[model samples]
Target: MSLLRRLVELLYGSDRALRRMLQYWAATCVLYVVCIGLVLVQVSRGMTDGETAHRLIVFGSWGALAFYALIRASARLGLKPDQLAVSQAVFSMICTMCAYAISGPLRAAVLVMTVLIIAFCMFAARPRQTLLLSIGSLAGAGGVMYWLQAHDPLRYPPMTELLTFGYLAGALLATALLSGEMSKLRSRLKRQRRELSDALETIRVLATVDELTSLVNRRRMHEVLEAEERRQPDENGTCIALLDIDFFKQVNDQFGHAAGDAVLRSFSIAARASLRANDVLARWGGEEFLLLLPDAAPEDARHVLERMAERVHGMPVPGVQGRRISFSAGLATRRAGEPFADAIHRADNALYQAKEAGRDRIVLA
Candidate 1:
């Protein structure tokens, strides 16, 4: 387990993209080890120059290790590793070209290394990026083949290099096309995730908001009350007001339900505009609104509702030609050691009194 933690620390990545790049670098380092082992075998068989192969192996191994450390160091300094993987691919290809320039009869081994580097980049880079890399690899290898054939065509045969070039071109082109399709799939999944998140937000709004008045619905108000009930007692006190529109049914009967709806919408806008930042007003039921004011004394709560009443009184009914609307409110402050429902019950009693003693007045409990 400790060794595993050490390996993860060596990667030094906290995000997916950078971690993937680090992992890819680690894989290429392993490939480097295998290639170095192959070079040692070619030395034993006397197939390649001993001094040139040894120098390539030593420097290539050091370069691979240094690349890993550089990526880790830069990530700690907040540099993103998105483009660094491409640089590694290009660097490894250049190293492979250097090896190919001196591999004699073992040049095919260096060509295979080029293939693996570009194939690894196919997974990391976009289609256009991978395509450009494929072309670069082809050019590098072609240049090496041309130089070898021009100077020493005895061991590096023209026919063999031509066949090798054709084979590599086919493999790199196929990898590029497949990478393009994979890039498209990744983009589609991201878009689908964004669309799903937006749909969830819309559903939440529909559940909590009233359609006609654009105020919080009864279910959501119940949630707010429950939350307040769980809170510690405040200094001034928490207050709730129950408001009912006066003669609402008479208005609906005299001028259709649509006009009544417009009156409710306009009244809701006016009432909401009069509230303080911390106050929450919800449509408790038809023609009824409940306002919750946290840390408010009864006097302060009454004053705010009275102001709301004046605003509602002056607001013109939207569909009705020349009519205006007014509301009556019952304000109650929560007492210590009392349940919130009991306080609201007292407010309901006060609201009944306000209705009986001619509507459009504020009653306190």
Candidate 2:
């Protein structure tokens, strides 16, 4: 099955037009083959219809081969596939009209085939196109009836013509209405799916990102930490750092909470510029953030933190009077085969040391 699917994909080239053309080609071939087989069976059963069978074989074979060639040529020329399918339907309706003109009993069969063709078009073609196909088929039936009545009045009686054509008109109308409703339903479903996808994306952002600073939240940071730890055994080093804004509570008290928020936002921007591309930064809690540095030793992690502290010191806080914002950070490199929690504990201890020794400093453990 896989091989067959690959072969089909190769033939169809993965474009919608090519795939749709392939579908039409396959269905046409199957229908023709079945008709030819039935005709053969009738001949074998002693029915003296060799001429009819011969005509069926010749016309069906020729039409199938010609249509297949057209499909291939159109694909090479970049023609629309749906147009090709529509052309096939028109050609089939023409053949049905010819059959109805010649054989009296085949007139009813032709009407039935026309109804099927309209139904197929209703699903496959646009609403306007489906209506056009139905109108054309009905017109063709009327023309064939007129020709039969003029040439061979005995073959098609008035009652037979009226019944067959009237029934076909009703069938075409019903099929057109169904196709229009189905098209409307399909459009509604497509719009709803797009809306659902957008809603899901919004929810994901809200869950994983901090709204104030637009940084990853603590929960996402923990996932990154765990993943980094698993990768560290095969890597050179992994380090974790804790950063706390110095005198953040004082900023909130002196100015206002709104000014404190502005400070946090400004600090987040400066810190991002100080870190490398592989570093991960997330809001840990109020006025506190965590940084994960993959492939960094304790010294390398401390350098990054120092640079970040300098950046924070340079940034102006609107709420604060004259003092620039600063943060103290604690850094710890993970040991071989050690649990991630131990590194975080060491980093926390280092943070306490930085706070004790005086704020706005970095301590490495």
Candidate 3:
């Protein structure tokens, strides 16, 4: 089992081809073992000549040693799948030729091994390689048949040899064509899977992120608030705040909408810089935003918001002159796993109170 695993790693290197290569190697080993055993049984029964008796033992031993050497070399020097596939094809052809030579013309059943080699090539090699291997296999087999017919006409008659060679060549070429079509389909499926994964990731980002301010959008903000409420224990604190830009419409009225956009971007940058790493700022609507401070009491939330307000007031927008950006805020601390909607409602009322009293102030609920 360990030897089989090593062979898979060396040949396919974790590709989808690994499983097919394992099956091929297992089948090849079984073929050799069964054939060698059968031939030895035939020798014991006195069914074959002394010359034919040597063929199976010699060929089986040679194949075992050659494969052991191939495995060792593959480990010492990393051989890619294509390189290993070509090497296997070459080795199989050499063994087939040796089998034909030993069996003689009349008992050349060893030629069927070429069919197995061609079948293995369908999965292991690319389309071009399969075609080339098929052609090479056909040529080798035809050469063997021609040699037998010319040298031993009584054993291998010309008409019978022609029909057998034609069928063998046709089967090999047909297998190559079918394998090429399957390879193309596999490649297309892999490409489609990758493209679909990328598209889904893109959609998720667009849904959560604001296009203009690069902040979390309102819909995602509600989800975050609800999650935070669930996470807070009875003893822990969760602070949330809603803020509105002070007289933002006046800014847009005096300076065009483009300048208003610049102001919003600048405010987002300044507020983000003033807050802690764990704090989350999200766009609630046009000229309105929400901020979340996890594990923070009402006082801690107020201090953070005050610092943010000062920072935002000092920050200057590029297109607006003689004006400083300021925002009115309302903050509420949830009590013992309080619902998010209840806390946000209190914050909204506090925000209205601040707006009525004066702009650019924080009122706690």
Best by lDDT: 1
lDDT of 2 by residue, 1-365 (tens): 59999987777667776667778678767766765565566567744267765775688678878887787778577766557767788877876675565444544764666766666665457777777887888888888787677776677786778787898889887887887888789789989999999999999999999999999998888888777766765454888888899999989998889999999899999999999999999999999998989888778888888888888888876767797788888888888877777888898898889999998898887
TM-score (C-alpha) between model 3 and the true structure: 0.73
Model 2 error, position 310 (Å): 2.9
Rank order by TM-score, top first?
Answer: 2, 1, 3
Global lDDT of model 1:
0.83
Candidate 1 ranges with C-alpha deviation above 4 Å:
1-50, 54-83, 102-106, 122-124, 233-236
lDDT of 3 by residue, 1-365 (tens): 59999976775466454545545655777777776675666556665465665765686668655764554455466765566676777777766765665454424567677777777776667889888888888888888889988998787788778887888788788888887988898789889988999999888878998888989998899888767766764545888899999999999999999999999999999999988879999999999988899988888899899999989989988999999889999898877757878888888888998898898999998
Evaluate residue 244 in candidate 1 and report its C-alpha lDDT on the 0 to 100 scale.
Answer: 97
What's the distance in Å from true for residue 35, model 1? 4.1
Stretches off by above 4 angstroms in model 2 are: 1-21, 38-76, 234-236, 316-321
Across 83-102, the per-residue lDDT of candidate 1 in tens digits comes to: 67677888898888887777
TM-score of candidate 2 against the unseen true structure: 0.85
Alpha carbon lDDT at 250, candidate 1: 85
Say which prediction, candidate 1 or candidate 3, comes out ahead on lDDT.
Answer: 1
Residue pairs with backbone atoms closer than 3 Å in model 3 (clashes): none
